[model samples]
Target: MADQVLMELGDRLRVARKVEGSSGAVLASRAGVTQPTVSRVENGQRVSSVEAVERLIAALPLPPEEAERLTSMAREAYALASEGKRVDSGVSLVPDAARKLFTAASRVRGFQSATIPAPLRSSEYAAAAGADSDSGADWAKNLDDAGKSFEFVVTESALRTWPGSGESMPAQLEHLLTLAQRPNVSLTVIPWGVGLPVMPPHGFTVCDESGVLVETFTATMTLTGSEHVAAYRDAFEALAAVAVTGDEFRRVVEDVAADLTRFIQ
Candidate 1:
């Protein structure tokens, strides 16, 4: 969704530049931004800052309505990354928009302290947890996209707590193990005995270092400001530091799954 907005804005800006008979270099000088930045904006690639978009708008010889339209589009493009807008809907409730973020990003890092991360959730698990079962389909498909990488750090308790039926949980755990084996996927688990470096209040996903989506009970907050995103990145790293990965992670999950299997029997 954000990508679409940026692309449209880029197209409009390109047309406006042509109408003004301005070269990319001329526009860059007029906007006081680098030529590459101007090129990126015109190409619909994410810009460094919202200020760059504003400056480009200011430099362009656009009519009042067109200028406002482009400005609006710019805001929407950066709304999740710059303004840190809060959407009332749960992240899972808007699958299409959320899917776009994953599709556009080259890397996605997520930390879940309570529940299974959405991308790693099985359909049955998601349905049992009251999340839209189909919401995670795109993520599952994206696992095959070798160009993108996904990393998830989850607490051991989250894996132990089965939201679905006893029979369903084994499948979910199996799904996690399968996903963990993917070349581009990394699943890490913080064991029960591991001491945490910091306590995170909730789960958050950072997309391509561009924005962080902090998930809460009622709404999801988009923190795109560089500082806020950096903080979340730090938090994720803190959790990942104490988490087990590779064979150790598999053992932890397998241990939980084994216990569950015994209990189910």
Candidate 2:
């Protein structure tokens, strides 16, 4: 994972440099680092200190906005490396390039139009939702890890809907009730009575600090471009605004679980 993050960090650094219209040697000279250090840093063969990270950002001739984005990404990479956790493995690799963004994320915003969000899903619920092959197991494990790593926001529709086994619905509602007890996790339900339109045609998962993963049945789309992310951020905030919280949210879960029992029977 470290190796993957290192390589990914290098790739982002290199991309930022190119986007700034600069050369590696030029950046090294501006940042007061040796050319090889610059090369290694960009290749993930070496980690850069916070000071060095700042210098590299300074070396880029990008506008203040773009430079700040690069700096934030660099700091995230350094922090992940410090923890010895690879940002490029497990569910991180979903949708390919989104892996890099998730590595640097401080928060996550997820919406499930058809099923419960993975992080809030129970082991049984997750299995029932889809196939139980190695990939599914990896996804469940990844979802569990992500739950520990970020602040999760879920819609009410996702919380109540059951797509798999009959018992899975009640189990899923119970599982979410348990997860919501965590300080880091915040679960909200978008009530059926809410006047809001359906979440944009696409299902999107946003990194609180960076990137957006827009998924489809066939392919997962990773969005890192600032403008695109900003749009999704707006959409997330809007969805969050109408979601049910606290006691009301929990009540909805229990009610849904009870309602689902009849189907199973």
Candidate 3:
């Protein structure tokens, strides 16, 4: 589990670097660390000092507050991993804080790189995903209600890949299609050919109706203040602009689902 936590953190770091249009070599150069150190840090093989984490955070597009939060998360993660615990599995500061943030949020915007959003996922898909333990039934209901207030953006790969926990690709894509028709839910797809401007990775950003919560396998980063929230909001909108919506989005999902069904046959 400690390894899981570390790897999760690493995944976030790697993805964030990509999202910022940076390479490990570039991050190392900016952070004043060796390229190997950067790779190990991003891979969760080595624990980073708070100061070192701060340096890397500074290099990212995050605000000071978020950078501090991430630095704190890294420190805590390092401590837990040293104790042979998964940073988020136990009743620790990270998971508790993440749950609170999720509960407190008035709205959410879940983005997926290659799977259906959990909030809209069906029982079949959820069961297939083996997501049983991490989140509970009440949490699912909260998301269901919150789904009325949240929006979502997914990439074309998510519709096609079924890379997340699920029974089958068709089931997941059908789930996406069903949720896309919901009255309060807005679903859009970033097509395959548009080309990602920043970087492509799997993750979600939540707007707490006031603040924002950014999740990675390692840390649950909270971003308060209107300025920070606005930045993510703008990004979501921009991504949505180039995406397909309404009938077009539905058609794409249907096609993907058909392909999956064919593969099964």
How close is each model in CA RMSD to the real structure? 12.8, 14.0, 11.8
* Tens digits of per-residue lDDT for model 3, 68-149: 7777777777666558434343222345565566667777776777666666666666666555443424445665573446
As a whole number from 0 to 100, the lDDT of residue 234 in candidate 3 is 52
- Give the per-residue lDDT of model 1 (tens digit) for 1-265: 8878888889889999999999987998889876656767887777657889989998998998888888888987787554554443222445354556656789999998778888888887777777753345545777788988999999999888866465668888999999988899999999998887667788888888777777666555566655456556766776787899989999998999989967666
Candidate 1: clashing pairs of residues: 81-224
TM per candidate comes to 0.62, 0.57, 0.56
TM-score of model 2 vs. true structure: 0.57
TM-score of 1: 0.62
- List, in order, the clash count of every candidate structure: 1, 4, 2
Ranking by lDDT: 1, 2, 3
Ranking of all candidate structures by their TM-score, best first: 1, 2, 3
Instruction: List the global CA lDDT of all models.
Output: 0.78, 0.65, 0.64
lDDT of 1: 0.78
* Model 3 worst lDDT window (10 residues): 84-93
Deviating ranges (above 4 Å) for candidate 3: 1-93, 132-139, 143-148, 163-166, 218-221, 225-228
